[model samples]
Target: MFVGHAVFAFALVAGAAAVRGVDSSRALSLGAVAAAFAAAPDVDMAYALVGVVSAQTTDALSVASQFWQTGNLVHRAMTHSVVLAPVVAVAAALWLRGRRLRRRRELVAAGALLASVVAIAAVVSGGLGLLIMALFVAVAVGIAEGTERLTDLGSRETFSTALVGLVSHPFGDLFTGLPPAMLYPFDATLLADRLSFSVDPTLNLLGAFGLELLTIWLALLVSLSLFGYSLRDAVDGRAALGAGYAVSVLLIPAPTLELSYPFVFSVLAVGMVGAAPRVGIRSRRVELPDRIAALCTGLAAVSIAGFAYTVAYLVA
Candidate 1:
């Protein structure tokens, strides 16, 4: 899976967490950081794809060839795994320390801006794109952490939220068909391909544009619905944030919502954060609950194994 796919998923979940005010700023920053971490694994292809001295066309592999070749370098490997997560995260955080501006908000915005740039560049040039992504997250986390340490924001909450964002990163990728190679020495397998190539382009454009359209529609409906509830007057902020999260999560099960789920969800999630209810949005947060999240994770693991088995059987 591409970094964008995982990044978008983490962004939505983390961003949603933030919008609800559960871990607002930290979650948002972590979302960006997770995106970077998700992206770091694929930076190697940078040499073959991106040109330096002169403008060069990056069409070394045909579509099918590209798909197959990805398995050689892109999938679960050195880049994707639990071991590399912290290593990459810390490196990214340190590098970003130099770019620190006075304002934390400004730092976050800059991190987002930088991440976007790297993602786009990777898509076009096709290098070790994930490295750029990793950098993006590092900067994001560093911005938040540095700011919290230096500024007035509570450090414990921000750090805790950032931890959540980081932990959730890999799980989101597994669902999107990109599992990190966290246990490299013990396990050598990379990824089990459950998705189609068509899903890629479709999700890309849809997420890039479709999300903007849906957010507006969803926002209007949510705002109107809140008019009738007595509690709406008190929980107006929470209601709006809930509505945004609902829209994002709802998009997950849609039939056409395949690879694009993360991106669409993320876009909607960011909007939801923007629309977040001002009260205790964080306290009233929505999560899958521990038991359910674990169950889902277990099922996902089995599914991947089954997918791999089927593929190997067919090949054999």
Candidate 2:
């Protein structure tokens, strides 16, 4: 779902920008900025992590519980609200407007980073935890800046593109889990129930997972289209088919971590299918067929890992 948010945002913005006669390079940069904004709401997960650390929850189950509990309040809260889109866009526009002010921007960013660290320290443990988190944020910010610089995207353009993603993000959440508080602060009400294909296991085994897969595939296809690449050029049909087979494991009914025999067998079947030869090696040049073979091999390895994990879980 996290990846879906980013990919969908990128594709949506890129496609729109292209339609508006934007250059490919600029469109890519705008898409990246939009994707970043779309995924930004998940920054609330940091709050959950801080809670876990503060509670000293060492066990897996305890940690998971704390994570989900915090997530329920913060995940689709104010950050994911429709109102946040314009607010963020305005801020981004102001920050990135006019000539680049590298020194001033760096100073402001550093100050904000320090303040965030101080706030987290007040809530969570100070010493090592605060330092670690501060370092993490610094690194993340640096990476983001580097990405923007690489794309050579102006602030105004980026902010304009980001508006679309920010606004769409909350609505997109409706397909997966609980709908976000689109009208937050003023209204804490959920916009709608999740749009599920079928909750019944017998009727629809894919559930939310299927929707996520579809979202990811659709996003990928849109992105490829924007980049002037055909589906065949961008993706290997054989590898895609292999992935489809592997995903069937998720459909088999199993209680949480418990794996049924059918699920286990499906995993093995997927592995076997992925491992099967679909292309022949001829020349030294790396062709699409070779890439397809490599993709299949990777899928096979993943399926094997899943099979091993299921067996281990069953034994435990």
Candidate 3:
């Protein structure tokens, strides 16, 4: 979901910028800034990581559960707040204003964004936790700086894009879980309940997982579209079908297996195969556009089939 957030943010900003007649290169740069901002909220997850590492968990599942539980305590609390966006943006702008200090603004922005988290973690988890979180902040800031550099966007453009991404990121969380405190500090009010479809194992695990896969595919579709590619260019129907077949085979229930394997594998398989070069002799090297189109087309076909199968299974 973290990657999804970044992809969605990039699509929105880059697509909007492109539509507004911005040059492709500049728009891409703005998208990079947006992607970085979208991912900034997750820096709070470092606290969860610290907790898991410090705990004496006996099993992998226990470790994972502990991490999830710890994360839920503060995942969308202050860092994900809409109110923090402007503060971080202003700090970033000031830091980047006159200095060509590559990515120094990103570091400043990340520090500003996570200041509250660090303070709280220092009190609740102690100095060690704070140090761990600070480490994660440094990594996040580095990523933001790297993204900006990759796009070659100016400081002002990057700052504006970051602001937009930060402002919009909290809303994206509404679909997966509890809504973020959009008006945090001032008002600790949740914006809305999470948007969820029934996916109880006894009822319809397939439907639930199918919906999740569809959401991811939709994000991928939007990303490709924003990059000026179409479904036809990214997907190969034959490859998608083959991938789907392989997934369906793997999805056949095995009582011997301990973990509950969901049908999302089929969707993933389709996407992977569709995105690859066609299994045929090519006269020349496959261009980027053609590869993307093949990938999208294959994924779309697999999604359609996967959804249909899920619906049919539920009805049966």
Per residue, candidate 1 scores C-alpha lDDT tens digits across 1-316 of 3544444545454646545765444444454444444444444444323333233334532432444344445454434445434433443343344344355654555456546545543663356544644544545455555644554334343344344444444444554344555453334555554333244444434333433333322332232233222322322222222223323333433223323445444433333332322344668755432332332233233223223322332343
What is the overall TM-score of model 3 with all chains considered together? 0.70
State the RMSD for candidate 2: 7.8
Model with the higher lDDT, candidate 1 or 3: 3
* lDDT-best of 2 and 3: 3
Query: Which lDDT tens digits does candidate 2 get at residues 236-263?
Result: 3444344344344356555231123354
RMSD of each: 15.2, 7.8, 5.5
Which tens-of-lDDT digit does each residue in 213-249 have in candidate 3?
5555655655665567665544555543542343353
Question: Cα lDDT of all candidates, in order?
Answer: 0.41, 0.56, 0.61
Q: Over 4 Å off in model 3, which ranges?
A: 51-63, 101-144, 197-230, 239-270, 275-298
Ranking by lDDT: 3, 2, 1
User: lDDT: which candidate is best?
Assistant: 3
